[model samples]
Target: MPSITVRNVPDEVHRALKVLAAQHGRSAEAEIRDILENAVKPKGRKKLGSLLAEIGRRAKLTDEDLKTIEQVRDKTPAKPMTFE
Candidate 1:
């Protein structure tokens, strides 16, 4: 786990955070963590795997189609980049 130091927050913001924390039955630090988490990683965000699955569904792809693709697909590993 990592911690951060947020410096020079306004007094009003600090007070509001404390009040909000009290209302939510948590410490202000926990409230801040929740706020930060939500800001960075929100609930309604679309993930890549889900979006790709949705696209496959829209395209009416089936297991047989996937198997066909896999049968014809290249199996070689990509070479790593090199600098001389």
Candidate 2:
């Protein structure tokens, strides 16, 4: 097993980590280990384009249906954003 030493961590960040660790009923070191593990691990999330493609595939939409959808979408104007 390999060990790592992290230095120069900000006091505010360290304090926050300690507080979070205490809330989770674990030591700060264990909390940090868990955080690192989660950060490095790959999360499963399907991309929007991929999901849409899959749905389109299952629906078996015709080329004319897709063309009509694009034509309708292009005709709709986008709403302007208002900032206070």
Candidate 3:
């Protein structure tokens, strides 16, 4: 196994990572390894996080807003969109 050293990480970011690592029952290094793996790897066609990020990046909506939109979408009547 190879090793990589990361330096100059801000204390705030490090503290957040420590909290998240504790919450997820993982070591800080393990949490960082996961972050790096997901950050570096592309999913299906594009990177996984980027796809979700872009959906929100394009739409200026919050979780509650998205939930409301989804509820409305689910309640709306669907008409046949095909043109004869």
Candidate 4:
């Protein structure tokens, strides 16, 4: 394993990191390692736009079908929601 040093971090950031580490029941160093690992890792879930594009490709929707769907969607009125 390799070691790295991060110098001159702001006081507030250090304080916040310490607080977060305590909340997660770990030392600041462990919390930072976890944070770094998560930041570098790819997310498991696909983004909405990517999923929609894939679905459209699989469905083989034509330009005319898309135009008609857009027209219908634009003309439809939105339903109101009631909260008790």
Candidate 5:
């Protein structure tokens, strides 16, 4: 697990966070973690895979079509980039 240190938070903001955490029945640290998680990765956010799947559904793609695409896809490993 990765850890981060939030430096120099204002006193009022810290107090507010503690109050909010108490209301939510969690510790201040847990509340801060939840706040950060939601801020970065909110509910109802559509990921790329989900979006692509939705598009495929909307286009009415079938299993056979997927198999055909899989069979025809390039299998070669990509060349690594070189900088001069």
Candidate 6:
């Protein structure tokens, strides 16, 4: 297996990784690895409305119900996001 080394890791990023690891019942190292792969991926993110609609489906909402939900969720505010 190949190994990768990352530099310039800020303390806040490290701490966030620790918390994420705990949330997913994984070791910090494993969580950091998962975070690294996901963060570096080239795939485009789902649109906020699409993600919300999927969540609604998982929650067993009917399509007629999800139509209204998507409309409302799409209107929800978008916070300023800066990818580190």
**Best-fitting candidate, scored by TM-score:** 1
Model 1, 15-73: lDDT tens digits are 99999999999999999999999888967899999999999999999999999999999
Candidate 5 per-residue C-alpha lDDT over 1-84 given as tens digits, one digit per residue, 9 for 90 to 100: 999999999999999999999999999999999999989896798899999999999999999999999999999999999998
Per-model TM-score, in order, reads: 0.67, 0.51, 0.50, 0.52, 0.66, 0.41
Each model's lDDT comes to: 0.97, 0.94, 0.89, 0.93, 0.96, 0.86
Better of 2 and 3 by TM-score: 2
Off by over 4 Å in 6: 39-84
lDDT at 6 for candidate 6?
84
Misplaced by over 4 Å in model 4 are 45-84
Superposed model 1: Cα runs more than 4 Å off: 8-27, 41-43
Q: Alpha carbon lDDT of residue 5, candidate 6?
A: 83
Clashing pairs in 3: none
Steric collisions counted per model: 0, 0, 0, 0, 0, 0
Q: Return the candidate ranking by lDDT, descending.
A: 1, 5, 2, 4, 3, 6
Stretch of 10 with least lDDT, candidate 5: 37-46
lDDT (C-alpha) at residue 9 in model 3 = 90
lDDT of 6 by residue, 1-84 (tens): 678788999999889889989999999989878977999887986888999878877899887885886787867578999999
18-68 per-residue lDDT for model 2 (tens digits): 999999999999999999999987798778999999999899998998998
* Better lDDT candidate (1, 2): 1
Model 1 local distance difference test score:
0.97
Q: Which regions of candidate 3 fall more than 4 Å away from where they truly are?
A: 45-84
**Residue range 1-84, candidate 3, lDDT tens digits:** 899998999999999999999999999999999999989887866777989889896887688998887887866578879887
Tell me how far the alpha carbon of residue 17 in candidate 6 is from the true structure, in angstroms, after superposition. Answer: 0.5
